[model samples]
Target: MDDIRLLPATGLEGLIAQLRSRGYRVMGPTLRDDAIVTGEIRSASDLPQGVGDEQDPARYRLRKRDDGAYFGFAAPAQSSKPVFFPAEEVIWRGRRDTAVTPDSAASASTPDNAGNPTTAPASSPHDPGFTVERDQLDAPPIALLGVRSCDLRAVQIHDKVLAGRTYIDAHYVTRREATFVVAVACSDPAATCFCASMGTGPRPAATDPATGEPSYDLLLTEIAPSDPDRHHFVLEIGTEAGRDVAHAIDTAPAEFDDQHEALAVTAHAASQQTRRITAATVRDDLRASAESSRWEDVASRCLSCTNCTLVCPTCFCTTVEDVSDLTGATAERHRVWDSCFSEDFTYIHGGPTRESVKARYRQWITHKLSSWEDQFGMLGCVGCGRCIAWCPAGIDITEEAAALGRMRAGGVLPTGDHVPTGDHVTVTS
Candidate 1:
């Protein structure tokens, strides 16, 4: 750890004020609609202090913790994907007119048949040509607080897919570059979480495997047991911007004491999760099990509602739509999040290729676990457990991988709902 600092819980106010003073909007975990959600936060009081959550397969509930620690819980229902890659965004907009050309700018004059300059048509006061609204897109610098390690990695994964050299998504690139990330250690992961097995989290990792360098600007670790009287936070500055924020807050250097030791203890406890990807080569195992009966087994219980993909931070599938006004003069092209689970997602000239739930489920899981390595040089899942907790069918990815492995091993499985006995599995994949 470089430049470790001890910040009292009250120091959060100074941190927020410093970020705001620097033209950065502070967003953190807050209680909204009976769930922990990331939104605009004004002060430390806006954070969900003394609040945690209980999460299981297809189940999640808010609960009060014994202590008043601000970051006591596991991941919230929503990930930080929305902040960088929104559910829907207007990439470009244009206005059509008989009086002017589509390529003409708002300031340009249209030629009347004689090539004489004519007054530019007033189309709702704004420009007629395609305009990139930076303010509407919120392209300013943003400070993301309380970001989990798994989600922090997810943002990088999305960058690889969207902002890669092959085909760059300019919007994602700008937002990602402008965004400031602050990671919070997951002291207590949920039952559905498998970040430990995925090698993504439980702790805010020092170096990102994707980038081969520090992943966050700053990292926060909660220490409650260490200072039983008052909750303390260990802040680590990873970048110069992080150091500037610490200086602004008048933070002091932290010593390697009981507080850091206590934080380590809580972090270790979070790694004792039962759910895990047992396969040594999860990617190869998934590829070999393509013909296994596990697909049918999982499809029987799968709803194909796209909940898992929507909540998943690494899922980057999307579709573009062109919507025009009633006059058909003004139009906008929007990019919306899409899921492979939808039968229409595979739609071609004729019809959807993967019509059956078995095929669709198989494709989705295989792509996430197997082919993603070939395409992106990494596994798609970070093991944040958002897919398991958000899935209405309670399909656990760990158990599914285990079940699929067994079916591929012997070409036989527990059929007719005999129930998995002694498998130590709580959720089905």
Candidate 2:
């Protein structure tokens, strides 16, 4: 690891300008209408500075903070995947036309006289022409600012699935490969986050250096108790590109050994506030409980709107369709996002594999918590709790999982099995 650099607040604007000048699109959190949204940002002024977000199930709002702290909040309502595999995309186009025949006179003139050894010229014949072309898209190099650590880890997991040896997603790789991640240490985490239990969290330990195989280029940690006039960022470079980008900013060398380590500990401690599920039995339990009564209870309140899958950072299922204009001359095939919660998602030649709402809900949860490990070598969920926080009915996944565990354990569920003890954790902000 390189020495930390002290960057003043104004240095942020310079960094944005540098990125834009290098032909890279700068995407970061910004205050939109009433919430923080990720989009193209041209300068530092575009950031959601001094603002915090209040997120709950089916709702998200922005609130003013006393301190003008930038990047001081939890995950946003939307994930960053849409930037790559968009919600909708055109896959192909087709046109229909009839074939044309050659002129009769010309054909007659092309007849050969075998006896006389004389042959006439061949006539030209027109045939139907159908052309198929793939859509050409280039993934521009992106500089992502203020990315939370959990989402950063999510990106890593996505790379493993999308760019793994077995199958490489051409679309995802084309757009996500060359991204420049500027990870922001979480100064404030939501009550719903359980990254600590997962061994990934608000702050990553410097001792466990990010593996260069798939590591962030730059990492930024905000020094707390910052005032409007005096703010500091502990910047560390992880790659050659990161070094180059850091050099562009007017900064001074600073020692962050103590502060950075303390922050990492604080972040880890904060993660304990979340309920922990024993991953040991999660897989077997999910497979065994596929037809359990707990699913029926969950499905009763589920609206089948598919909000959970949509907000999830890892769900990547999609569907395609073909549409033609009213004139019937032009047509296009499009690929769009889909969810297992939807009734049509399980459709087959005859009908859907899972007919009841209970079955669909069972499939989704089981896949996420259990089957995913067998399929991808990692859990599908990152414990972000977006599903619980965004579900219209306020359905808590941890609560439901605990309840099912009790049913499976002969009606004797372990107390505080997944609940936060409030002893190992502490929150400063």
Highest-lDDT candidate: 1
Worst 10 residues of 2 by lDDT: 420-429
- lDDT of all predictions: 0.78, 0.70
| Reference-based TM-score of each model | 0.86, 0.83
Clashing pairs in 2: 57-389
lDDT by residue for model 1 (1-429), tens = 348887777787888888888888777888998898888878889999889898898999999888777888888888888877889988887766343444445456556797676775755454444433333555567789898888888887887888875898777877777677778888877888888787788776777777776788888887773355666678888889888888779567787784466467446856567788853577887888776656666787899999999999889889989898887677788999999999999899899999989888888888878898889888888888888898898888888877676656655643444433344355423
lDDT of 2 by residue, 1-429 (tens): 355677776788887888788778888887768866677788888888888776655556678877767786677766676766677888878775643344533455444667564565554544445566677776578878877766776776777777765878677787786788777777676666666665556665332223336356677777653576667677777677878888988777766573565377446546445565556677777767665667656777788889888888888888989897785566788888899998899899999998788788888888878898888777777767678778888666666665566557764333323323222222222
Displacement of residue 196 (Cα, Å) in model 1 is 0.5
Q: Against the correct fold, how does model 1 do in TM-score?
A: 0.86
How far residue 124's Cα lies from its native spot in candidate 2, in Å, is 16
User: How many backbone clashes can be found in candidate 1?
Assistant: 1
Which regions in candidate 1 have their CA more than 4 angstroms from the true location? 99-138, 225-228, 258-263, 411-424, 427-429
Model 1 — which ten-residue stretch has the worst lDDT?
126-135
